[model samples]
Target: MSEITPDLVRHLGVLARIQLSDAEVERLTGQLDVIVDNIAKVSRVATPEVPATSHPIAMSNVFRPDVVGDMLTSEQVLQNAPDAADGRFRVTAILGEEQ
Candidate 1:
């Protein structure tokens, strides 16, 4: 097990721009030691055969057959528009006259 010293915690506090009282430093030392020990335990359990994975289950692409279907005519699409011209939808000018 690795030991976490008060001086290390004090230095970390300075680097992180955080202020820690003596009591906090003493408490954090034990806490940090436990965290490091737990990580080491996990590392020891890991093996070459155990493949690394971000997710638990295997995944594959789910897709449907590509079948062409009926499409709408230009007039059918433009029928609902408030304003249309030359087989297209028209809108008010957004830019000022400066251009």
Candidate 2:
């Protein structure tokens, strides 16, 4: 198991460019020690027989297949538009072009 000493915590604070007081350093040392010990316990339980995975159980894509179906005709599509021209929906020019 790795030891989380006050000195190690102070060094990490310097590397991270954060200012930590003596009290904070002492407090963090105990917390980091617990985290390291917990990770060590997990490593001991892991076995070669178990396949490594990001999740606890098997996962797969649950999405439906992408397939093209019947499409809307130009007249049917333009029926709901406020304006239509040349078998297409017409809108005001955004770039100041006179129509």
Candidate 3:
């Protein structure tokens, strides 16, 4: 079991960029001590005999066969555009620099 003191909690808060009060740090230190101890016990039980499995259920590649589909005409593709010019969608300048 690891001891989580006020200093440890304060150091952790600094690393995580969190501002915690003295009272909050003290409370968290106690809670973190218990959490760390529980994790240590769990780690001890996880032995080499047990094969490491990333997921609980079996998974297979869920993919669809690549096949060519119907194509759309240039006029049909530009029909829904709010602003179109010269068979292309006309959009406002996205950058300050001139193209």
> Judged by TM-score, which candidate is best?
3
lDDT string, candidate 3, 1-99, tens digits: 468888999999999999999999989999999998998887998899988888999899999988989989999999999999999999998888775
Candidate 2 Cα lDDT to native: 0.91
Sort by TM-score, top down from the best: 3, 2, 1
C-alpha lDDT score of every prediction, in listed order: 0.92, 0.91, 0.92
Segments in model 3 whose C-alpha atoms lie over 4 Å from true places = none
lDDT of 2 by residue, 18-68 (tens): 899999998999999999999888898788986778988889999999999
In model 3, the number of clashes is 0
lDDT of 1 by residue, 1-99 (tens): 456789999999999999999999999999999998998888998889878887788887799889999999999999999999999999999999996
- Per-candidate clashes come to 0, 0, 0
Q: How high a TM-score does candidate 1 get? A: 0.54
